[model samples]
Target: MSLVMQENLEGKAEIPRIINDGKESVEDIISNRKQISEKQDELEEVDRELRDISNELKSYDLPEDVDVSSLESQRSEIEGRISEMRQEIGRVEHEIETLDEKVDEIDEKWREEAAKESKHRTMMRKLDFVEDAHEELTEIKQTILAQIRENTEENMNRYFNDLIWKDEDYTVELGEDYTVSVYGRHGDNKIGSLSAGEKQVLALSFMSALTKISGFNAPIVIDTPLGRISSKPKKRIAQNLPDYLMDTQITFLMTDEEYTDEVRAHLQNSVANEYLLDYSNEVTEVKGR
Candidate 1:
């Protein structure tokens, strides 16, 4: 997999492939995230007020030492304060309801605007939107996301199986927070537990699947394609990768470990041009392989 695909699987903190190559700049999407954050701040303020009211109501508890009948005047004062607090609480509760309604309205508008912009609505969703729409928009967003994830997973799994030359079965699930979970014979496999070579394979598979599904015919360039894998897998990859890519052009940046004699022999017929970089004390030179 490529760095871009790895970034997508890791989290949205790193930029992923831009599904919309339209005139919209990165600033536009970032602005959307910022707007969502500001709206969230507003909601938090309303929540704090509601919490304060609730705390005030709880504070009206009478002390165990106090006698209600003996302190009749004090009891009346307490009653009056309790009544006033209840009314204020009701008012604050109403504000919370109103704020929630407004947030829902804005969320709907944002979804509509994203659709109109021809951007991927799934990609446009922010964490605040997910939390705010917990009851209302969760189902709607899940339905859309499920469909896209299913297609992407199917493509990704197929490509991974073929490229990795593995006989076993595994599943790929695209999760929330831009996480990619791999399920193998053990039920669930953590990406962190995988070796560097395995990570590379997974990333390549995902990138290939994304490109295929997106209907993009652009050439692919992979840096350090087989840097970490053991000998057996490297041989298999070198032999199979060109065929897997088919007509799509692929460029690989490789060190001596990756572009070994075995790899060169496997790619003998497919090779169009090759180069060797020679580095010395001051300068470097590129020579034909």
Candidate 2:
């Protein structure tokens, strides 16, 4: 029985028996040491992690006199302020959106106004051109009218001097309004002071000057040619008339009171025909001489 028990113990104690052998024990010891070195490296890594966690905890450590309640209140106030700022940001964004819309509307209006301005500018240019043309035409009209006034005035003076009794004592002026003025030797207007005979002579001179300048060769007929003239003036006028009207055909209708013997003597050489009217039983017949 003791032997059987010993045999069982020897089977359970095989590891001890193997440890007693030097080569097998040494191999087992080397393997165990490698496992221990691996475990030690793992332990060193765990220790470094623990030290890092402790250092982080030290950083989070509160001071002895730190106010938790005040910090909590400040944090709550900061959160409230942040919430208000978010609301303000939302309102500002809304306002910016409205302003952008307004800006776009203004840009559209500006484009329409620019188009109208372009059209108005074109019309203004045309207006300027028309105004310039009108001004040029007005200037030309004034220059032509001025030239006519000057020529008429010169011709009036020449004919007036030749026919008038006091020839060298008067100057005639023609105004822009076609009004005639006669200035005497003393530069006084003598038109209102002239006698009927002088006035008639002046009218005849003016008519002759107009006929000469009219560029028309039509025959002139004068009724009662020397009716308002004195005897001496009528004789002088009759003498000068044929010479002055040399190129024109003129007929003078005269009465017995105006066609005196002296006037007829001065005008007989220029007279082509003379006529007498005989009235009987309210019937008149013109007989030529």
Candidate 3:
């Protein structure tokens, strides 16, 4: 086999080999059997005619007034017919024997084919088992994902509530697709309509909730933290984010304007391993703070 076909086979489950090639097809075998049957029927008809001729000869009676010459002529003609009928019977019997031999050969092939068919059925059953297992695994995976989403949704709303100080009536919705939306007292507040500060806050809350529920331990990193938001929302996020992500390590990439003295004070006790990036001679150096 080619390397590709071999690799494919290695990745797949074992199945029965097909044994249908290099032999007459089932349809052809059936046609041969039908012909044999037809010939046998013809043979039977010929035998019946032979028996009828014998019966006619035995049951024949001549009138006492009939001439002797006429009787002999009639007997000769009857004998001639009987001879011809016997010859036909012999030919038909020989034909039937030849047909029977062919039928036997075809029957043996059928028996061998039945064995292959049995293997094919077994393989089909194995395939059905694999299909059933896949379906069950898919259902289990969906169930787990649904439960994770539910927990994520709960966590998202909780974090959103803590971060969003002004919008107490707003609720966070986490879709199965992991898209986050905020619902206000009036209706759904579109993410596109939110101010930059609000978007940052929402993103922080959503990520915190997702990380908390995902069951994977990883560090949280945010680039340009609170860079786009106004002063009020910036301070709010700076105060809340550290507490929300207390369980995981967080790294912040920020500009001087974004990381104010007040925000630093808010994170003083929780902060660890702070660094500054200093550019000199077309290269940046990491400086410990």
lDDT of each: 0.67, 0.71, 0.71
**lDDT for 287 (candidate 2):** 97
Task: Write candidate 1's Cα lDDT for 1-289 as tens digits.
Answer: 6443344454432122232322133334455455555555655565565556557546878678756455555445555555565565555555555555655655555455545443333433553366678856778888877777777788777767666756777777776554777778888775667778878888987887677666667888899989878878888878767766666777788998888899989988887888888998888998996
Which run of 10 residues does model 3 get worst, by summed lDDT?
13-22
Task: Say which prediction, candidate 1 or candidate 2, comes out ahead on TM-score.
Answer: 2
Q: What are the per-residue Cα lDDT tens digits for candidate 3 across 6-121? A: 44453332222222321333445455556656655665665576567557656877567756566456656656655665566566556656656665765665566565556556
Cα lDDT tens digits, model 2, 171-219, are 9998778788999888999999988988888888777777766767689
Estimate the TM-score of every prediction. 0.46, 0.53, 0.63
Q: Pick by TM-score: which candidate is best?
A: 3
Give the lDDT of residue 240 in candidate 3. 79
Order of candidate numbers by lDDT, starting with the best: 2, 3, 1
Off by over 4 Å in 2: 1-119, 217-219, 242-249, 260-274
Residue pairs with clashing backbones, model 1: 1-203, 1-204
Residue 241 of model 2 has an lDDT of 73
| Lowest lDDT block of 10, candidate 2 | 14-23
The Cα error of candidate 1 at residue 284, in Å, is: 1.7
